[model samples]
Target: MAESGQDQTKYLKGPDQIIPSDVLKTWEPMGAVKLKMTKSGVDANPPISVPSLLRRAADKFPDVKALCVKRDGAWKSITYREYFAKVCTLAKAFIKLGLERFHGVCILGFNSPEWFISDLAAIFAGGFACGIYTTNSPEACEHCAISSRAQIFVVENQKQLDKVLEIRERLPDLKAIIQYIGKPTSAGVLSWDDVMALGEKEPEEQLDYRLSCIAANQCCTLIFTSGTTGPPKGVMLSHDNMTWTAHANSVNIDFALGKEVVISFLPLSHVAAQMSDMYMCMYSGVSVYFAQPDALKGSLAATMKEVRPTVLLSVPRVWEKIYEKLMEVGKSTKGMKKSVATWAKSIGSEICERRQKQDFGKPVLYPIANKILFKKIKKALGLDRCKIFISAAAPISNEILRYFHSINVPLTEIYGMSESCGPHTVGVETAFKIGSCGRTPPGFYTKLLDKDKDGNGEICMNGRHISMGYLHMEGETHEAIDDEGWLHTGDIGHLDLDNFLFITGRIKELIVTAGGENVAPVIIEETLKGELPCIGNCMLIGDRRKFLSALLTMKTDMDMDTGEPMGTLQPLALDWCKSVGSQAKTTRDILEGPDEKVMRAIQAGIDRTNSKAISNAQRIQKWQILPKDFSIPGGELGPTMKVKRSFVAEKYSDIIERLYDV
Candidate 1:
């Protein structure tokens, strides 16, 4: 794939790097208002670079444990001083290996210490870091690398390295490929050990000079979109964007400095995880523990039990799985155990309700409930020490929220896109409501545009936390951010009387019916899922059709090794089937046998959902269940489990057409 005889000298220059002219050209006018607010003022935070934040954190908590990684059946700790020292060393090593300024240092892997080090070192060396999702194909990886003009590419293991090696020659700007987890088999590739050795041999003079030239306003990272609508566009984020947002998040959550602990398992490629696991931890001096690579699959609970973190952030699917498992276990209880659990749950729910209303007075049975049920449940889930639980990326069902609340774990919702640097609004302990995205945090402003009769409009945000526009996509960037610096999030939502933001739907996902009525499918889909315990996923389809219909997937077991959905129904789903007097053991069994009981139950759920529809257009008139559940490997869900609505619609066009045809 190599273009023979191409000049590589420019990329191999020493550490006296300046932000490239092409990269500078990508910076749009961030608007006069934004610039004004960015300047030091009485109410604004002084702009700080990420490198500066890390240095301060190291100085303040030199001996405090900052990172924990499991190796050889044991957890190993790295202190703040050591973490800072290693980052500086890696930065110097990148310079020695000819990393260019403003270019990308692309990392591909699961969450790990090496991934964290690679990300920060790239920024510290005056280059922007880009994380490629582990689920991305080789072509997708090449797209991000080429778009950013990446020079140094780091991967976690052989699998990721192989993806790069297959396309390495085409990456004309690439200077080195470093494999962090294991030794590289390819010629001229560097191992993680080689990087450290290079750092040890390199002098500190040039690295220090490079660090001095760093600025807060320059782009330091690129977060690629999930590409559901089209190809992924790199969202450029400035150092100030990361640092300020981290500080704001810490304040919003009331993070305890050097005391807050978190599990790092979510895909780091996403802005939410990067801001939380990496930047927020540095800003707050919080300790981070790396979960196993398969944390999402099954091992996360073990990690949680071991670490017992104080802060937890997850996408809704994780919480749903936990809830489902708890319910499955609860179903098996008999006699006295069942009676006590039922009583305890009621008491817990009552206590939580009182707490939400600012009443600390516990129900008379609260002590007994806490001792008999709540405490044990929290301990089993390894959330006994958890003080904050945040759910983001997508809307979580209120049923799941209420279920957790009843168990003494309230899930707080945070809302934002990558363009807003992860969070523009967050639910805090004192002001959160179920299904609400919470209030805009300090240092950010939210406004609604083009309001309908109901007061719902497109959500817009303006703040120091907003990103520096998309890279190399000026037209798209302009469409997203207006002249006043408001990032026009295409999401439809409204601020309540108390300023809590409730997301209704997305403009792009709106299913306009043939009757000339606009329909938001998410509310209907969520409502349908809430009515059907056996259903794993639901996608409402009928854009420009006569009426709404849905494509449903029954909750089926998954092949954990391959991350593919299996035909057999999940235990929760089987229990649900049994409750409906159906003996179906698999999705195939239910569909092929045309199980009257199961089919009737599903139809009843649809009828119940339709009964509450706001309009006839929003009602589900017909629906069909798919043979398998949605999964990451199945191309139905994204990395964080957000449904790829467009993709799903396209994939099921035949079935949707059949529904309309009939």
Candidate 2:
């Protein structure tokens, strides 16, 4: 926990203010480090507001492709000028609808051009915009709208609108509902066209004045936490917080204006997408392509081939699938193709090892290997033009990172939270570390609080990118951010001498055995998955128990072509199960009624994991195969694909008790 140089006396309110001793101990001040590009005038003249960033892009790169979206089976482009104009019109429409400055307008939908436009319009109109997750239940949506004191709600279509309508009675402050597509099913609901028409009648001067009046310190967006532990909190990010992040990331990554292309598919509700796909693109003048909700599972490859984006941001699951597919491809190859693939992969591994050791001097075989092997692999994955591929939002397996890097993909992992306005630290390709999450970027300083014998502690951060605080939760806000402005990220990690961060696990996720031995479950879980490729999701359970146990799920129901679920076991998965002597013919049978042979295979994996455990207590004593994998729709995972540990534990408490009962 590091403190900034800002005056702390102003934060100490009330005459009887006695700060807790625990809080005082956590406030260890640390020195700030600047990004290399910052010294060379990279962020010398950063934009002050989101609207200003969009305006600057339109003014300087008017003819540049600002946005592309698939419509009528064709990709349609919107130039910077057109984007700015649309944003302005939307802003004017919000004004005409009587949206006052600093009022809240919530967008509930999937990621699309309309969603982005609506977000910018809110900012342009001096309104604080918030996004509700598409996977959220009606009750969850109600919570967000009520928490933000939303005055207006925007829905993508009938389904999203239905959720809002079901909870409309609970949101008394709500004044209007706008639907982006289709006819409004209820009276008082406005269509997208109707809003735009209203904007045409409103004076443009009003929108301009509102944008001008917006201050950098004013809150512009409310991003809710994933609510893995409890109800989601609205993280209030100021205009300055977002703008600084966009500028810092652009400069650090060396983004090329009007040249870099990106695909926007991650949920807009998350700050990661906001920072990388929206704000950074606006500031760096990068053309962004929007993908449909089903595109990732249906036409992601086709879209990627068409766009040939230079930057790709994705979650760990997507990368894992890609890695698995590559492995499957290798397994299915024969004869000369197989031999060539093996040789190429060996060369790739050699190059990766050399690069990790800082040996940039190329070996004579490297170029040949690249031409014959790596180049073709990259093209097949539609990543031939990709310069920066980022995996974030959740911890990715080191095995997956190594596989990609071996194939000439400079895949890197970043670390951050919604409270930090996206990423505070990112692995640069040149300085990438396999297991570490990279160094703290410019404008941010990190410190470890309450270190243990292993030097691991809660990772605390302080910076311009930090959010204002949770909306309307003063007590929780104080608990998260101290009086000195340091945000206490509950994640547990340690930094190396070079400032590279290695996240071990979350403090809340630590499992303590009955004997009082502490262990990080994620470490063991990741190890099991790495060793047993068939294991999709693993959860370790042993709090207040004699020994650790696990709940396992297999990656079975997936489409071979698109990596999308086909609602049954894939042929490859079935073959893998059978190869291990399983008689199961379906995903249900493999999981719910696993044969003795399948059980033996699972036990073998646990035995291998136990051999690597530090102590008997750390080893999993027993385990069970879950009938199904954790998913967002099932309420077992968050929108970001992170397992809701508490929820899953509670939902399967009977199964967990059965493990210990034996």
Candidate 3:
């Protein structure tokens, strides 16, 4: 990748960073708005401590409840003073336990006061904090623990603690396990209370100076990217990376999330949900209503009703589910409901398109449909009070975007990853393009690398938001970043004539057709996913064959109309036997049960889908869907849920041979 500088602004500078002309054009407007608003003292640092943010907000509104920790089925308040004391105690204990500056520490648990506290304590104690997703398999968890070489880990309960212990022998650096929430772990383990006891024995002294070793530019958080391709790699992010993330969000949209209620339902492990739900909530002093882990929809609505959250963040999969539900309801209705739903979708798409025409006014709407259909949809999703809905992690379909837009929900599309510290680019309804991602985020310099005449190239950027580097992978870092210090993002996209970005596909995810045509899987995946939410994902499987085929997984429904589990809660073998004509479409050779009904159904789906594909890239034959779901342990997936294509191909070579031979 060739890195070049085309400077327009003298203010933004780096090794090879340049201020895009489009960025310079909006500098004045951004400056005016930034100048008019005061920068929050939330990010004060020699330490870049997040606890400092809570303290600042607490000082402003001391009586205002800082955090409401729910436990024993009762809502309890942790006032500012109490919260600070708890954090300080944890920080002191961590110091007493040999946690020093820049040491990697892991937080392995669900979202709780302790999770947040441990994260703050680690940063305050001057170590990089890593948050691992709770749902990660034992192997996935061990991979992260080993990768980071984390000396200290803070877990919530025994199950989490046991998972650590199971992998403890593999991770020699794992010295201590701190239980923040739940009953004290087994007698053999040193509990969180034991650490607190150490702090209780010492008198408080020199709080600020002890944390002086940490700097604003120092590595703060090392988040693991859910590796779609291979092993999960750690993204080293500085304090500035996190701070600029909050600033970028504030600058681009009118999402005054700080002063309103916000809900935390997403996994704090992911950057999109974490940055918005955790970092943003902490800095803004927003009331966060965390829902129960199992009760997503019910708890979501309950939390929404209780807190009346004005800010929301979700992935497109969730939106797709809701959109499908809404359509199902509309389809089931007679005249008015169907018309209302249809009109709402139409008007929403129209309003979204008009905003692209540079019109900035109240969105035109059919008031009756807006109130009855759109408004109701918003309330049902617990998004009535929300000023904006931000979607990321994956590409959202334009149809889904328009569906929510019609209901007066402004769908803001954001693009970034853990490597970016958080999202670096986002779109507001007013400035967004339907199919395009959006303009460059604030505090980042974006440009296309290796572009041809039409300016399509791999997207690269340099800014405060850029990650520090890959943890313990200098060679990979050298491969990813160039000599000029730009992160060569593997995404392919172009800046349109209007300066909005339209992502074409991933450079790495391209497939070659039998006719020697280069086709992008991401484009086809997005299109197919948009069309059929029920068809989980489609893998276009033609490289040098006469045509292409696909392996399909179905969108599962846990609860049915009867309010019971959709599939057999019995044994996997029994379930497989029963789900004969169900969603069992996968590679043929990997098939498990008797070949009576399922074989016919799988073959039928493949045949129907093949008719849609052209001659050289069409499915000629296939096999039954694999009985196992993809995972590291299952040997079908990477840690980040990306299919292990080569592994799968090799594993089912026998079946693939039969299918092709015939």
lDDT tens digits, residues 98-158, model 1? Answer: 9977789999999988898889999888888999999999999999998888999999988
User: Which candidate number has the best TM-score?
Assistant: 1
Residues 1-662, candidate 2, lDDT per residue (tens digit)?
11334333332221112121212211111111121114334334443677777888899889999889887888888999999999999999888887876578899987888899999998888777899898888999989888877788999999899999899989988888999978887878999999888887888888867765665554678898888878998888877678878988898888998789999988899999999988999888899998777654656767787888899999998787778778888788899988887787777777677776767666678788889888898888888898999999998888888888777787888899999999988887777689888888866789999999889999999877877777777688889988777889989999987789999988789998899988899889999988777777899999999889999877766453443333355455666678898867665776565477888988898999999999999998898877766666567777788989999999999999999895
Error of 1 at 370 (Å): 1.1
At residue 73, give the lDDT of candidate 1.
95
TM-score of 2: 0.91
Q: RMSD of model 2, in Å?
A: 6.1
Among these predictions, the greatest lDDT belongs to 1
The lDDT for every candidate, in the order shown, is 0.85, 0.80, 0.62
In terms of TM-score, which candidate is stronger, 1 or 2? 1
**Ten-residue region with minimum lDDT total, candidate 3:** 24-33
In candidate 3, stretches whose alpha carbon ends up further than 4 angstroms from where it belongs are 1-54, 79-82, 206-209, 295-302, 362-365, 452-455, 513-516, 531-533, 544-546, 559-659
Instruction: Mark the regions of model 2 whose C-alpha exceeds 4 Å error after superposition.
Output: 1-47, 558-567, 591-593
Local accuracy of candidate 3 as per-residue lDDT tens digits, 1-662: 11113222343222112222211001111110001112443222122335455566566545555566556787777755566677778888877777765576788776676776677777777676888887676788888877766778888788788888788788777767788765674755667778878877756653343455444444567788776577888877655567556655655665553366666667677776668766776556566666655433334556666666687777665566567666666655788767667776677666666787876554455675577676777777677777867777777778778767766677878787777766767777678877777788545667898886768888887665666567777677777766555778898889988878877767776667667765655565555555443444456565665555555544434342222223222232233434554444332322445455655654555555455654434334444343433333445553234456767767766655655574
